[model samples]
Target: MIRLLRLLFWILIGRPLVLIVLGLNVRNLKNLPLQGPAIVVANHNSHLDTFVLMTLFPLSRLHRLRPVAAADYFLKNRVLAWFTLNIVNMIPLDRTKVGKRGEDPLENCGKALAAGEILLVYPEGTRGATDSLAKFKGGVARLKEQFPEMPVVPVYMQGLSRALPKGEIALVPVVVDVFIGEPVAWAGNRQAFTQALQDSVTALAAAAPHPTWK
Candidate 1:
């Protein structure tokens, strides 16, 4: 039922609806691992980023893709929470206070990756102030540290924030580009690996700022 609903949303609404606004350009499509359990890490600036990423992938993989989202934001509303859990395949992480289980939030992420699912994460922890990236948090590093064999793909999203900023509700039409960079190998040190991961994203952004609109 969840897969059917997601297929319907993507076919009837999600993909077609976004074409009216989003102009997605993915560079180095081959960079996306042909298989998973892999992790795609991107800079977070807007909620729209997740949709943009999913729309770019084939429907078959949609069911296999899981996004790590804020438990506080997506889970508060029962209706939205239901859709997020069932349709969106979100792994809700508690960014505020730890849950009663006291388990590491990233442990859930690792579990997903271990389960052969494609996981998407925002290492910045939250939306940034602008197009510029915020210093990456170490959670992503910890995940990679645990699953060193799983490839970490770096993706950079530019212009989505303008389409849907941190505080806005209404969607605005804007040309957005999704940059996919070659998988970056994790260095042993967490700090160094995070920095390298960040630089990979930066390179993708600099290489292709946006698609040429004609």
Candidate 2:
């Protein structure tokens, strides 16, 4: 019930509102995976990444999507905390602190996938200052190694940084484009797969249109 309502509210109201008010324009929706359990790995440009994905995907079906977020930042403030956990269904990930056994974020991601849920992980640990994509972390590779069967979908978002710039509140009206790339398969070597995954994500982002004017 909650999932359905959330999905309807997002698509019917939330997405339209953001689209019209913020001038958001998602170019390639067909590229996004509509079914199955897989990793929706995207480039980290701004905090808008989560909201954009949540808006783009079906909320009811997306109930199983666990967006892996940094515990320190998202869980710190009360507003961002509530928004991330309840609104976006983000899973808190300890990016800075190390847990017992030196567990990595991929372990938690694997658990989510094992439970039949899709994961949204930013290859870049933190948001970038510019629209250019950053170097991906090894967590994505680890997650692939843990779940070789799960497909990793590469995604690129344009003009998000201008729409909602880092350390800013006022949303500037801009056409944000989301490009979903094809699913990448795990070859053989774990290390090689990780590098390939990162490279693929970077290449996808490079292909997508960047913000020319805010």
TM-score of 1: 0.90
What are the RMSD figures for all models against the true structure?
Answer: 3.4, 3.1
Model 2: CA > 4 A from native: 1-13, 97-102, 210-214
Candidate 1 Cα misplacement greater than 4 A, ranges: 96-102, 210-214
RMSD of 1: 3.4
- Give per-residue lDDT, candidate 2, residue 155: 77
**How many times do residue backbones clash in model 1?**
0
Q: Which candidate is the best by TM-score?
A: 1
The collision pairs in model 1 are none
Q: All candidates' lDDT scores? A: 0.81, 0.73
Backbone clash numbers for all candidates listed: 0, 0
lDDT of 2 by residue, 88-155 (tens): 77789886554456556456667788888878888777887674556666776667777777788887
Angstrom error of the Cα, residue 131, model 2: value is 4.9
